[model samples]
Structures are given as C-alpha cells and as structure tokens.
Target: MSAHSVPAPLPCPAAIRLHCAGPLEAVVVAALQRACFPEDPWDDASVATLTAPPTGFAVIALDGQEQPVGFAMARVTAEDAEILAIGVLPQARRGGIGRCLVEAVAAGSHGRGATALFLEVAEDNQEAWTLYKVCGFFSVGRRPGYYRRRDGRVAALVLRRNLDGA
Candidate 1:
C-alpha cells in the first residue's frame, strides 16, 4: 500500500461536527498531527497550550464515527489572530475538512473581535497556499528561510486575511 493509503476515504456526511478541543481530545489531535505532519508533530505540551483559553483556540472535526480527522489551531490577541497550525489526515484531504477547519477558526476569531487573521505557509506548499487564497487570504509578505527543513534548507510565505470583509 502507498504511504497515504492507510485511512480509506470516508464519505463526509452532513452530520459532521466541529467542537472545541479539551484535554480528552489530545490523543486524537496527536494522531492527526502524526498522520498529517509527522516530521513536526505537536508535543503534548504544545497541544495543551493551544487548547488553553485567551491565548489560543483549537477545533476538531469529527466524522459520523466520532473520530477526529481534521483540526485547526490558532493564537489570538485583541486585534489579530494567527493560524498556528492546521491539517487533515491524508485520506481526509480534498474532502472539505481543511475548509471547515479554517471556517471554524475564522468564525471563532471574528466572534472574539479579531479584525484580521494571519498564517505562514511553507513556500513549497502550493496546495495550502491555494486553499488559503480561496479562503480570502492574500500574500502580505515573505520571510526568507522562515521554515527549517529536514535537509537544512528554509523557505516561507506569509499570508493574511481581513476577517471583517473576508
């Protein structure tokens, strides 16, 4: 089997739900991180920090089986919110999970009075860049060598969206 063929593509039902992350959700979140980004999976401490109040937000997307297949994490202040991380298990990609996660975060941030949201994507991550653009984010700047790769090279692109108008 191929590396991405572990989880079969499950039909996304209309009943899918998004919920706030809690301590009990850590394991699922870790699983998602491992599946989506094993090279830089979040540690327990980091997940704990992201689920804490005031400084951060984390949302999980649960399928009909009540299994988590997607997630998004963000950090927010009075005026701005930053998408700290987001991912969907390989089988879950291209099925609207990522969009749902982004929308969930955007709604939460808007409710908290954030006027804008920002995120940094790897320069080579064209798929993610396209997704963010479709979600109303636009290139605001670039940070050369912002992301360190396993092979020692670095590249990054900064993107932002105005929550009020977008």
Candidate 2:
C-alpha cells in the first residue's frame, strides 16, 4: 500500500471506525485493552509508555456510538514489526472489528517501511489464530508454556507475514 493509501475496511454487520491512537487517547485505549484482555491487561502506565516511543504506534476501533471496542498496538524497527497486543471486547467479537484492527496495523506498518510483521498468540485462542491465518499470517514457531493462566500454562504460537503488497 502507498504511504498515503487508506486502509481497507473489513466487511461486517455494523460499521466500525478505525484510527491511530495518539497520546491523548492513551487512557481510553488502556481501558479498552483491559476490557478485552482481562486475564493479562496492560496498565495505563504501560500503555502510555509503549505508545509514546518513537517506534511504537496504536490502532483503536470504535463502534457506532464512538465507544472503543477494540485496539491493537505494535512496534516497528527498520524492516520488521511486532504486534504487541490486540483485543476486542466480548460484545464485539466476530463483528470484524478485530480484523479491521489487524489490517490497520498491517497498513500502518507497511507505511513505516516494515516489510513484515510478527505476533504471538495464546495457543488455545482458536478465534485469533484463525483470524491471523485469514489475514495472511502463517505460523513460524511456538513457545511452550508462554502464557500463565489459572488453569495451567498455555503455549504461544508465533505467526509472521510479509507485507510486500499490503
């Protein structure tokens, strides 16, 4: 995609707004992140710290009412980028918000000179795994017991995709 090209919108039942979150939206994005990943959410301080770095950026998805329903954050360095976190509220699941957020990241990363993007997802998160696959990411590695949970440790699958034509 060209540096100024608009990110493609995901097909879904409801309309969703996607935008790059700035320093002013840090607190709101942190709250949305916590709502989506209650198991291990980043604190407001962490969100502020991550989003302020030169290499870091955030994408937030909002519903019709302008409420945050999902968010994705990533860091890019030179020709590579890594998705740090992405989450959609339970109420917004399967509505295409998550996919849109991912696309936003991919487009933004491509614009920043990143040739590829990587992300690690909990092994048991079938929905997310499927989403990534549909979005062109392929599994490249796995880390055992990477996520600590109340029941037991869950593995994390690393996925990567080239953004040559994103």
Candidate 3:
C-alpha cells in the first residue's frame, strides 16, 4: 500500500464518516471506547494523553446521524506504528465500521512514515482476528495470558500489516 491509499478491499461504508480525532475530541472517543469495550475502558484523560499529537493520533467513526460509533488510536515510532486501541459499538458491529477504522489508522500511519502497523487481539476474538486477516495483517508473535477474561485468561495474537509497500 502507498501512503495515500486505504486497503482496496475494505472501504469505508457510505453512511459512516471517519474523522481524525483531535485532542479536544478525546472525551467523546473515550466514551465510544468505553461503550465498545466495557470490560476494559480507558479514562478520558488517558485517552487525551495517548492521542495528543505528533507521533500519536486517533480516528473516530461517525454514523450518518453524526454520532460517534467507533475509534482507533495509534502511535508512530521510527518506522513502525502500533494501534493502541480500537473498537466499535455492539450495535454497529458487522457493518464495516471496524474495517474502516483500521484502514484509516493504517493510512495515517503510512502518512507519518511508518512501514508497518501493528496491533494485538485476543486469540479468542475470532471476529476481530478475522477482520485483521482480511485487512492483510498476519500474526508475527503472541503473548500468553495477555487478556483477562471472565472465565480465565487468553493469549494475545500480535499482528502486523505492511503499510509502505514493504
């Protein structure tokens, strides 16, 4: 992929608008994050700090009504970028919002001179794992017992996607 391109196979749905969230929008993004991942919520202040500027940035997905529905936070360092967090509301799942957020982050990271984008997903999260795979990400590593589940713990699959045509 080039810096100006989003993954060709995954396009943003017409009804959804993707906005690059500034620091001022951290609170709203935090709320959406909480709604999407009630089990692991980041406070507004933390969200703000994580997505401040320069190496850090966020992309928010809005519905046609202009309501925040999903978000992706990422940071670029050297030639690599990592997705700090990403989620879409339960009501908005399976509608291509998550894929849009991933592509947005990937494009943003590429713009910032990143060669690869990385993220970790719980091994048991088939939905997200499948999405990443479809987005052209491949598992490069794994961390055992990385996620605390209600039943026990699950491993985290560390996935990566090349962004600079590397």
Candidate 4:
C-alpha cells in the first residue's frame, strides 16, 4: 500500500473475526487506544475492565496474519449500552474495519440484552461523526466544551441508535 492510498471502503465483516477481548489483550488494546486517541487515552486497567464478564464487552479485530488491527469496547446493562472507545490503525482504516468493530459491539451487546446504544463523539471529528451516522446513529444532544484538547475544548455530540436491527 502506498503512503497516500486509502483502500476501497467495502464491508468485509465476514473476513474478520471479532474476538472477545480479554485480559491478555489489554496490553495491545491499551497501545491501540493510545495510538488512536493521543489526546485522551485509556490505560491497561480500563481496557481490562471489558473482561469482567457482566458489565463491559470488547472485541478485537485481527487480520489474516492474526495481528491486531482494531478494537471496540462498550458497556452494557440490560437494554442500554454505551460505547467506551473504538479504534482502527491509520493504515488499516478506510477498509471498513472501524465499521465492523462497531457492528460487532452492537451485535454482541444486543445478544447480551441491550437494545439501544449510546455514545459521544467530539463534534470536530468529522471522520468519526460520519462513521457513527453511517452506522445508524443520530445526534440526540450535545455537550458544549465537553472534550479538552491541547489547543482548546471541543464539544461532544451525544449520539444514539437502536441496536434491535443489528
């Protein structure tokens, strides 16, 4: 792949396995989170919380070589769920990995009895906004200056979607 090439954005959910993330994956998940969210990242403990079995759920996407490429984490409580974090390496994006990670989270959460999913995204992050919208999320509210950046604060757009269809 060239430095400037963005692979065709095609849904290849079948080719990837959404493995349940566990304690063993914490090290990798933490690194991916930090690389993807330099401004605000989660630690190893936070990533390991997903393996607690009752409240949180996480999935790691691995390529054909069994290398981690992306992940999604969420919290589920009965009929409600909230996304905590998600990321795909810069080189692996535009290949629908992010979207698949989200779908995996939704499907897994729904299987665990969650019907609605909630999340917040920085308003200025158009890439994430577009991804959420495409995944069936809609803006339900906004928190002004909710995210702090080195330069300034950014608003957080609260997004929600029904996972019943996923």
TM-score of each: 0.86, 0.90, 0.93, 0.87
Q: Candidate 2: list runs displaced more than 4 Å.
A: 1-6, 9-14
Candidate 4 lDDT, 1-166, residue by residue in tens: 3332222234554555556776777888898889888878888997887656788867777787778788778889879999888999887888888888777777777778999999999999999999999989999999999999889999999999997775
Candidate 1 — which pairs collide? none
Q: What is the lDDT of residue 86 in candidate 2?
A: 91
The residue-by-residue lDDT of candidate 3 on 69-152, one tens digit each, is 888999999899999999999989999999899988988898899999999999999999999999999999999999998999
Candidate 2, clashing residue pairs? 1-166
lDDT per residue (tens digit) for residues 1-166 in model 1? 3321112133334646777775456677767777888887778776877767877877888787978888878878998999988998888788777877887788788777899999999989989999998888998998888876888756778889998874
RMSD of each: 7.2, 3.1, 3.5, 6.4
List ranges where model 4 is wrong by over 4 Å.
Answer: 1-15
Which residue pairs in model 3 clash with each other?
none
Output the number of the TM-score-best candidate.
3
Tell me how far the alpha carbon of residue 79 in candidate 1 is from the true structure, in angstroms, after superposition: 0.7
lDDT of 2 by residue, 1-166 (tens): 3342236445533567676775667898899888887888788888877877578888887788877788888889999999999999898898787788888888888889899999999999998999999999999999999999999999999999998865
- Can you tell me which runs of candidate 1 are displaced by over 4 Å? 1-15
lDDT of each: 0.78, 0.84, 0.88, 0.81
The candidate that wins on lDDT is 3
